[model samples]
Target: MDQEKVNILLVDDQPAKLLAYEVILKDLGENLVIASSGREALEVLLKTEIAVILVDVCMPELDGFELAAMIREHPRFQKTAMIFISAIQVSDIDRLRGYEMGAVDYVPVPVVPEVLRAKIKVFAELYRKTRELERLNHELEDRVRARTAELEASTAKLRESEQRRSMAIAAGKMGSWDWDWISGDWMWDEGQYRIFGVSPEDFEINPANVQARLHPDDVDQLRKAIAEFNKGTRAYETEFRIVRPDGEVRWCVGTAAATMDENGRVVRVSGVTVDITERKRAEERQNLLAREVDHRAKNALALAQSIVRLTRADEVKAYVNAVEGRINALARVHTILSLSSWQGAELSRLIDEELAPYSLGEQIKLAGPEVQLLPATAQTLALALHELFTNSAKYGALSTRAGRLAIDWQVDDELLTLSWEESGGPLVKTPQSRGFGTRSLLASIESQLGGQAQFDWRAEGLLCRLEVPLTRKTAAAAPGKFDTAGSAELQRASG
Candidate 1:
């Protein structure tokens, strides 16, 4: 049964009869509202939600039958149960009329309260159960939708991972092969045969023939790798040079794992082989390029020094200093580019490297979000920092041991502000004339970066600020990018 109280409406024309019914049904534990007339009862029903209605049939004007007919005509009250109560003896025709007016049952005057209470309890329980079932159904539908969405996301991730793996294998020119130790059977993929430079008809499919193809210098290494695999300490991985029939020497990487039987005896070995010939060639080419770059860099520095010497004069010292500073700035940019395979440099890394030599033990504060810079932006920034560092080392806070520098930057909308401040130096004064370094710094910021630069020669120390448009694509692809493996190989070859 529903724990909530049921609301009932009692309608009668006699006040004495209404009082008597209220006293009788007081122990029913339901909410009861009494109305004196059918018109008043209908008005109450329209304003409130009545679960059941008890009406008097023998009244004047709109009696119980007319009120019941009105309720039945309205679609809102179609489910409300009606009971007709009267003292008159109802014939078959009257009973039929009451039934046609949507009466559930007829109760005579002096009704039995227990019978009405029991019937209303049954309907209340049904309503409660129906509501509970509807709530559970809604929750079940929500859970199903959530689970289906999770399944779809998982499937999409799996498909993307598989596609990436397939692309990697194809791009790297790698293929898998298997060998049975007990049966002495060998199976090779097309890529493996292609890497070995052997036709299917010519392949001997034997261990001895495979060993003969490996370079003599790599035989010991190959044996060591196979020994490790047999001992179960690690998988087999060996790189060796193979001499093809067409007089080409190519490098290949082979990896395999041993499969053991139930008793731990070696049963088979399966792995993949990748052709690394192109990668090796690219490494060699990079080495040559690095050497060429180093030679040209030295030549360029020597040429700048020559210009400085030829133009040397007491009045031209500022010009010479500026030229040397710019040359050094170019060299620093080259160093950073070479380290990143000429891709780009991180702005924070560039700043730290430029200021490290001067701020050895002191606390050097940097405040900004980490940002990357393009090669052109890096060059311009490096030159500007070089000028600032040179000026500090010569005449600013960096000239003393008890000095500190703070570098900070911020980005707002399309503009970036970079500021440098120093303190704890000898009492400073404004310079009488701007030096070559200062003019060069200002010109570089304005012309190269399309920005403004300001210098404040305060009594405490020098302060420089720059405002620039931060419009360049920070993460765009560079022209000459090298992968990690290729860069490592090139470094080794160059060394």
Candidate 2:
């Protein structure tokens, strides 16, 4: 389709005629091929793509009619425009033959130069336009194929990405939404309807519908947050509570950002929401436990200060020893408390921990059902037990070889009744004065633990009775814990 390089073949037997024809068509701005005979013309046709061929009728071997027939027989040359030039006058039969051979025109010898030039110009222009159209058609076909491939690839990537996003959102218990400010229509994915506890058919995701289900306290706060986001003041991030139709409350956290228009105005808001009710409940419980631990610390400090102030021993060393021993007893009760995550401690283990230093045999007997006491009650009773054991070992039952002590407790109704009595010891006598040991025990049992204790000075032994009120308040069983020792024989669930 190179316009400047279109081929034109000129065939004549005489050298003079060939020169004359070339001179006539030299100004046409096309490559011209000269053939001295029909055979030579066929060779030219084979080598080059010809737009037009002018052949002489009188030739030694192949005439103009024969050349035209050869050109028509080949498919590539079927559309090649052919013109025949005869030097002698043509017969009607010869003219018909030229026409039958696919000749468009027959030029006579002494041909008019202007008419021949005009005819060649017409065919040359037609050739240029035809090649140009063919080129354009090929280019269009290539472009369409490339565009189709691009679209197919883009669609595949989009489908793959959407599948991954849906899986991630479902696993995370999250939902996505889009709000168009101009249309006032909401668009939600499958996850959004599920998180809100609504079926897709019944769900009306509008501003009013959203506000209606929110907790009364959080509605205004969420609105304010969104308003600020629209005003270009802050990024949207907030947590709020939602009330379900069945009257259950759940917490949710939302975050959104705005898409801006060309004029820098808000166009749409897109965001995600997640259910966080369980996490919020856990946080509340942790805060309450922190406060309770702080209260225990303050009370323990006050009790220790009282112990130091009230001890009336004559020697400083004896007083220090007594305080140290009482504090260790309190620490043993604290061990069981930590094991149960500050829930409570078993009563029988507390008894064994206090009496471990003394010989644990028939001389010292203990019997009690498994009772889990509150941390405060355990701490108070641990100090009292320390005093009782020290007294029995020094001057009471355990002071003699045949001495025996029995400590037993039983729960009846809401009261825990405990008794401590000593027998098989030296003749018992009452002390002349009440010491810090007796006072501390009385104060801890009565004031700290909210319980009562009585002492009886009898001839055979000293008897002490304590009654404590049990309440039905506390947490469920602590996780990852086992019952303390000696609980297997006396263990029983609360009745």
TM-scores for the candidates: 0.40, 0.63
Candidate No. with top TM-score: 2
How good is model 1 by TM-score?
0.40
- By summed lDDT, the worst window of 10 consecutive residues in model 2 runs over 479-488
Candidate 2 residue spans exceeding 4 A from truth: 1-164, 229-234, 472-495
Clash pairs (backbone) in predicted model 2: none
C-alpha lDDT of residue 155 in model 1: 91
How many clashing pairs does model 2 include? 0
- What lDDT tens digits, residue by residue, belong to model 1 across residues 6-124? 67788889998788777766776778899998889888988987777878898888888999999898897887878788788888899999999998888775677777556655555
User: What Cα-based lDDT does every candidate model obtain?
Assistant: 0.71, 0.77
Candidate 2 local lDDT, 236-313, one digit each (tens) = 888988887777888899988888888777788888988887789999998988887877666556556655555546
